[model samples]
Target: MSVIVGVATLTVVATGFSPHTAERETVHWSYQGSTGPEHWAGLSEDFAACGAGREQSPIDLPEDTAVGTSSDEAITIDYHPVTAKLVNNGHTVQANVSPGSRIIIDGTPYELQQFHFHLPSEHTEDGEHTAMEMHFVHADEAGDLAVVGVLMEKERGDSAFTDLWDRLPTEEGDEAQINEPFDLAEFLPNDRDQYQYDGSLTTPPCTEGLKWIVLDDPVSVTPSQVAAYREVFHRSNRPTQPLNDRVLTLVED
Candidate 1:
């Protein structure tokens, strides 16, 4: 049997049929069961690449990899909460972002589009599971993607996420305000040390060329927050893919 890979950009078109604009790309994707990661390539012509990508994402980091900070290329993100709309596209829980939000990575500005939740966390530490994970997806001026991951663990009491948890849309396609602005800057850790590498998207049609930065510090979130995410995606994470000789860089804050 020969391994086949298909892929397509998530570009959206404003007219006719595509929701994405000429500059924007939208992807058709799915997760779990027969249609899970294993079937992504066969399911769609655009997703064939998912099955044959050289650099995939969500790798389990070895516990004793001398994790620390060094370089100063640290990026700063300044995000404000807005009336985000929740859209369950049969993959993971995703949000349709409002306007007026942007993320700065090492001074390079990227516009915030939408974000989504992943459970049991996607990236792992020494194969250990973090309670939850939130992916704040951003795109640069050229439409390139740079995803900033904030890992979540059990906390003693309420944290900033409680506000988000309370406001998370229950049904797919439901939209709501957080009762306040959602700032992306506040959600980031003080130490900007991260593991940077070239990787593909975790979801179907799992496109490559994304600049992946997995933060070292795991943020705190109430158990309720974890449970809230579980309600939507219980162990919805795709299994950790192979490294394939990719160089994982540990940068300074």
Candidate 2:
């Protein structure tokens, strides 16, 4: 797929006492062609996993799986309302939070670093795809990465981000501050049934040894919300990767 990045915007619009960032943006990569996913591995040595890694991400989750109920396999998010820096990197709308937000599994704590989105989602469920996906990336003190994927589809009511939509960074390289406090839980679906697997970063420099947790229940988001993203990222998601020999463990709640 061919894509064209949008021009940056400088206007900071506000409504109902909430503050949002101005629109500024740039195109980061592509889905096809010389700069597309197919050519990512050759783009740099750091991205070799894009083509050669035995464990890649965005696998088609199998409906049947070994259920895991152990405490070590459970995920607990410890997040608080905080001001977030919303940036439009051309690839996706990324929200960067300050220290304090984290997720604890078993006894290890992984600090929430940042989160980004993918249009129409990159992962599939039984050969099916969600309207979009939100990846909440966290890392331990040792720098090991764990990502939480929340799939989204259209539904009733406005988004938790409805108040911040107009303030989203729309132009490439645009960095905007959301004056309103945002809660991570406000965006997650309540259903916690999920799948877990070891995989690489979905994007280049496709580093391996990362933990992927995908919630089975998708959160509700409208097409208009997705359409806003489509305007910035013509096509932002990487293609679903090969499953290779990896075992996907179902996280039973």
Candidate 3:
């Protein structure tokens, strides 16, 4: 079962925020070419679970499932935009976040630890694809998982994006933080309609038991932003998997 929540927005834009010192930590990644998603778990010992997990994300949604109750959850999210730095992971270019944001879903609140982007979209509908998508990863006090996805399309006059994209970090392991607060509501579509389902993570350690919500409407970005993103991540979306008889609900007004 699932529930959808909605909110209003202020004239929010993404731009030069602030830059932070790169916290040195030992971590593994599944990037493109040599270390892509297909070989994430194999790349490092920390990601063994990613390869052997039952539920994974980016599965193709089949048009059939046993109907059940629609979700009625109300979510409250707290996100601050800092300087967002882009890195060309082997799989794609990603904008990594500082660890202080959070999201509340269905009366349950989760912290927004980090976020990333995907090109051509990892998730699809009826075999159709969106131009780009963003994933805000959150976790609750108990470590449960929920994701907030914002989809993007080609348009014009996105100055916030222009500022951010213009100064993206060209190489991996490089980061900059923006000190300004980025209201997540700005990225949301005016319409609150969404789709809810059960799924897993698209990356390695493909853990299951995730609450997946994808907004039906997509926000606009300038062609230059899209072009810049392509230059970094020509393609990083995971191939959609079989739905395995799962249910998907379209939240309607």
**Which consecutive 10 residues in model 1 have the weakest lDDT in total?**
11-20
180 in model 1: Cα distance from truth in Å?
3.3
Deviation from native of the Cα of residue 212 in model 1, angstroms: 0.9
Which digits, one per residue and each the tens of the lDDT, describe model 1 over residues 1-253? Answer: 1111222233331101111235533443334555566776876676676788888877876635634556666666667767665555334556667777876766778887777767778898888878878787778877777777778777877577766666666654456654345676666677766777778777755677877777888888888777777776555677788888887777666
| Runs off by more than 4 Å, candidate 1 | 1-30, 63-69, 81-83, 105-107
> What's each prediction's TM-score?
0.81, 0.86, 0.72
Model 3: per-residue Cα lDDT over 138-213, one tens digit each:
7677767788777777777754465566556655445555556565556667775667778777764455788877
Worst 10 residues of 2 by lDDT: 10-19
Of the pair 2 and 3, which is ahead by TM-score? 2
What are the per-model C-alpha RMSD values against the true structure? Answer: 6.2, 6.9, 9.7
> Local error of candidate 3 at 66, Å?
9.6
lDDT of predicted model 3: 0.59
- Candidate 2's displacement at residue 30, Å, is 2.1
lDDT of each: 0.66, 0.72, 0.59
| Candidate 2 segments whose C-alpha is farther than 4 A from its true place | 5-28, 65-72
For candidate 2, the TM-score is 0.86
